[model samples]
Target: MNNLNKELHLTNRPVDMPTLEDFRIVEKSISELKENEVLVKTLYLSVDPYMRGRMSDAKSYIEPFQLNEKISGGAVGEVIESNSDNFKQGDIVAGMLGWSEYNVVNGHALNKINPELAPVTTSLGILGMPGLTAYFGLLDIGQPKEGETVVISGAAGAVGSIVGQIAKIKGAYVVGIAGSDDKTDYLMNELNFDKAINYKTTPNMKEALQEACPNGVDVYFENVGGEISDAVFTMLNKFARICVCGAISTYNLPSNEDIGPRIQRTLIKSSVLMKGFVVNDYAERWSEGIKQIAQWLNEGKLTYEETITEGFENIPDAFLGLFKGSNLGKQLVKIAEPTYAKL
Candidate 1:
């Protein structure tokens, strides 16, 4: 097989602070596949906040990305060569493939997707990890009940957007908080979130939450932690459920890791049940969650957004965009043409 030889690496060009060029892609040979391994070329690489956590050496749910080394994440790719019966050449698959244009990984790690059920990239977005995260996080953790009020921050992004809609599916009144009025409008007008609040434009977010909920937030699916969370925290009703998903607002902070809403006083008064989670905790039930979200989508009950960048080389920039709020739903870098998903 002819090797397509360029790969990206991290560059220190932005100085101590990491930036896109911090990684560079150089020519390399097509890796020799070991027994049970497959040489895969990435088709679409996902850019997510969890990748940002992996960039820093700080203690996190997983080991941080190694400095000046090739970084990897969830990606859709084509299997060019395979040594295992489970996979074959020309197979379109999704796995923990990385930033590179190509990679060689365990045959067990890759799951081949048939191209009729959905597009190939959907495996890296709504049909894959992010979809599962929103599904299980809201249903299993947040436990939204009918007629209850559910509020989500980062409500226009991948996870929060699904959380809000799933809450609506359960017959809950869903309110969303986003950074811009455009995002607010989409959440309300297009995504069908019961109400959308532009956090930056609102004079009093707590009042806005109060107005939206009317009865108070019964389930708070928090994604952006900081001032937005502080306001939502103030409106929590008795026995409220809180799922702490992602904290994009403070992700770029230079220091100060201690996190709690400024309105801690409200927690004591409301007796809210709060739990922070990394989505992988539900990886065991991943199939069930994904099927449910997909069924909702197929039935037109769930809608998703994807801010896609076209090319493999733009992975770093795509990941950076998450912190800047440049994406509408799931942010991804497309590396190849679509493979029709069958199931």
Candidate 2:
């Protein structure tokens, strides 16, 4: 194999919405693998809403991407060269690797993937961080009960979609809020959600939400913020629980001006519990969540959808699709097909 590697680097930060010009792809030569290091050939790369925060030089839970350096995120790849005892060539693995065709990483940083368990691409979607985010956020923070009404914002997204399904598994009536009628249909018909609301078309979100959640919202999995969340807040029942996850609705806004309607009074009046969390906060119990989700997946109790964009050059386009609501479920960029042979 040639020693050339292609990678995408953050060139500039956008004041509003991100544009393709903010990133530049460059080619470099791959280096020799050292002890405890493996050379990875990326197969599937993730383009998530969270990555948008890292694009700017802002104070955040994770460090911002350095200008002119390779941007890194979740990726599933095959080992092309290994100098580590723990991994051998051709082992499929998942880790935080650079947005590149090839990456040289420490073997300890990667989790070995069993191709037979599920599709390797799932390591970047339902069976990966997004799935775990839904599990812990809903079960731990939302704490839904049987016969309760659980409302999920950004319901057609990767995380919200799973949250609604898991709520159903727990015997709660699930209501999903998506951006389009097609996405709403997917939620109601395909995922078996109790109801689905197209926020884009609905003239009165509060009235629609009130109609859908006749029992009042007992658990709200908040993935999109702004006007959608304000409406959900108005529908909260006593002792309601809210899990504040990614706020894709406000990610593109200028940091200083990113504000919304006050909800402190709503929380105080209803005795609602609202908590925000990053998925890494549950790192210690990740395996447990993965085990349960995988079981549900195998038994057909859980299912997922993927909006995969082909070719490495379309990575930025796929990522931008997240903001425009161009994807139905999990949005992924298929860079290359996996080679299932050990060297």
lDDT of 2 at 333: 91
TM-score of each: 0.92, 0.98
Candidate 1 C-alpha lDDT tens digits along 49-84: 877677677787998777666788888888778898
In model 1, the worst 10-residue window by lDDT is 9-18
Clashes of each: 18, 0
Which lDDT tens digits does candidate 2 get at residues 1-343?
Answer: 7788889998998778999999899999988878899999998899999999998778999999899999899998998888888898789999999999999999999999888778887888789999999999999999999999999999999999999999999999999999999999999999999999999999999899889988999999999888899889998999999999988988999877767778899999999999999999999999999999999999999999999999888999999989999998899898987675532
RMSD of each: 2.6, 1.4
Lowest lDDT block of 10, candidate 2:
334-343
After superposition, candidate 1 runs with Cα above 4 Å error: 1-4, 12-17, 254-264, 338-343
